[model samples]
Target: MWIKSARIVDPGQQLDFTGNIHIEKGKIKAVEKASSPMPGTMHEEVIDARGLWVFPGIIDMHAHLREPGYEYKEDVYTGSLAAAAGGVTTVVCMANTEPINDNPSVTKYILDKAEEAGLVRILPAGAVTKGQEGKVLSEMGLMKKAGIVAVSDDGKPVEDTSIMRRALEYAATFGLLLISHCEDRRLSEAGVMNEGALSSELGLPGIPSAAEEVMVARDTIISSYTSCPVHITHVSTQGSLEIIRNAKAKGIKVSCDVTPHHLLLDETRLYDYDTNAKMYPPLRTGADRKALLQGLASGVIDVIASDHAPHARDEKDLDFDVAPFGAIGLQTLLPAVLRLHFDYGLGLMQVLSLVTVNPARLLGIDGGTLKPGSRADITIVDPSTNWTLSEDMIMSKSKNSPFLGETFRGEVVYTICNGQIVYRKNGI
Candidate 1:
């Protein structure tokens, strides 16, 4: 297979040029620039990717694939479909299912389901504590042997500082990354929207930024004290960014990711009881949004994840305060990211690295680069296409997305995983 004349942008190789890629046996065999053409002596699939953008298949380091439980919301197969459409060839799903992926059996179950689907690569994160109770430690060594890439309680924070410290140490013994969902339930008690004048005007409970920042502080300090790496997921506050930046400056082994929803929207959109806008570490003020953009520039933010939390239509239709706190984002991740490149004026490489090389390097995954001998996972995009996001285009079983009806300037035309075309846009 050959991808010809496309503007191949591979952050792994720090490459950006018109090129041709040759694939054989599900691996990249060679990357030839336009000036250096490969010998053409065969009849095989040749994609004329002219006037399009080719990138390393996008990798989402954090997401929720509700399998073994909550299939009504989303499951492994549906989540893989959504991932392929979003040009995400690899996804690391959180461990917050019915049984909670605290044991090796649950971890194996999720991996087995993903293998059966065979659409995209799915890695499960093991729970930090047994049943996610935050009381007893989970068998990290056994889970790691069962094929979990990391350990995290996913959406549920290990509230006990002593427990978290031990989790970090235990995870280190197995060389597993520990991802922390930094949230203090007490500080964010009964809150739905971001705390401010907007919540006051609407008479809804407000979740303060301090709720997320205090926990970020605690975890960063704990990581520093223990000298074990910690990854903070879905960071949304200005103070949290500052704390992470200081921690990094002080040589603390801590990293963080910011979701597209938190970076793109603010509390203003929640005035009407729009349930799609609700999420843990809810959207913040415009000032905080600006700080996040600046954080991307300052290198404080290491990853740009979708946090692809999906909820059913019925659940999202309820009142804002009564509805679940999340929105479907897998299909919208790429478009929202293009906004940063086209609208926010960030360099394309800098923006792409947040989703590509950065996450791949941090997570130690194998699919974020298009180098020779790597998996032939690729995404072809038309950056000039203009279209509005509609419900029918969504591949997730659930139809809860904050970006619905929003117009975007880019679209994924083809998604190739393991040298096979898994998704192609209509009429493309």
Candidate 2:
């Protein structure tokens, strides 16, 4: 396949230029500047990407592919399709499925399913605690052998500092990245949305910002003491960002990701009691949103993960108090993130890094690059396409996103995984 004349934005190589990408046998054969002489070769397929942006396909470090038990909400095949539709070539699925990905058997099951589907790359994250109970450490060494990219009890935070400290030490010993969900259950208990004036006005329960920041503090301190890198997931609060910033300044190995919903939406949207807007570490105040934007642009936030938690329609259609906390994000990932560049004055390359190389680096994956011999995982985006998201647009099993009906300026025109066109918009 020959992808021609596209603006290549690969932050890993620090390259941004209109170029031609040559793909052969599931690998990047060559990347040539548009101005260079064209090679004399027979091409079976050609994609003219003029006026489009070509990026290393997004690597979402945080997502929930609820397979092995919750196929009613989302399965691996459907979730991968959703991810491909959104330009994500690689996804690290959280270990929060029905049976939970704690042991090698479950991890292998997920990997085998993903291999059979053969869409995007799906790396399973093992549970940090056995059954995610937080009382005992999981079989980290065994799960690692089963091919887990990282270890995380993503749906719940480890409430005990001693347990978290031991997990950190074990992660250091095992040479695996430890991902923290970073929520204080006591502070966030019974809360449905962000805690503040808005919650009072709406007469809904609240989840304090301290619920996230306090855990961020605990994990950062533990990471510093153990000299291990801890990656905080779905960071939504300014106070948490401050703690991470301070830790990084102190030479601590720490990284974190911001979700699209956290970056684009605010607590005010919850006034209607839209359960789809509800999520763990729920949307915060406008000031927090501004800080998150700054964090992304200023490099304080390391990655732009989807946090693509999916739920059944019936589950999210209930009253706010009883509804589950999540929003389906895989299909809406790119367009929502593109707003950062269009509205927030962030450069294109910077925005691309948040979804691409930065996440790949944090997850320790061999992706987010267009160099020769690299796996041909690529996303071609039409930056000028003005599209509105609708219910039918969601490819996941559940349509739980709050961004439905929202219009955006960019769209993923083509998603290529391992040199194959897995998803193409409008039959391009």
TM-score of each: 0.99, 0.98
Q: Which stretches of candidate 1 lie over 4 Å from their true place?
A: none
Model 2 shows how many backbone clashes? Answer: 0
Candidate 1 per-residue lDDT, tens place, 1-428, comes to 99889999988789999989898889999898988956754787888899999999998889998998899999999999999999998899999999899999999999999999899889899999999999999999999999999899978889999999999999988889999998899989999988888899999999899988998999999999999999999999999999999999999999999999988898888877889888888989999999999999888999999998989889888888999988888888878888999999988888888888898888877878889999999989998899999999888989889899999888999999999998999897
- Model 2, 1-428: lDDT tens digits are 89899999888899999989999999999999999876646646889999999999888888999999999999999999999999999999999887989999999999999999999999999999999999999999999999998999999999889999999889778788999999999899999889999989999899999999999999999899988889999999999999999999999999999999999999988878889999998999999999998898779998888899899989998999899999999887788778888988888888888888887777777889888999999999999889888888889999999898899998999999999999999867
TM-score between candidate 1 and the true structure: 0.99
Give the TM-score (vs. native) of candidate 2: 0.98
lDDT (0-100) at residue 22 of candidate 2? 90
Query: What local lDDT score does residue 9 receive in model 1, on the 0 to 100 scale?
Result: 92
Q: Write down the lDDT that model 1 would get.
A: 0.91
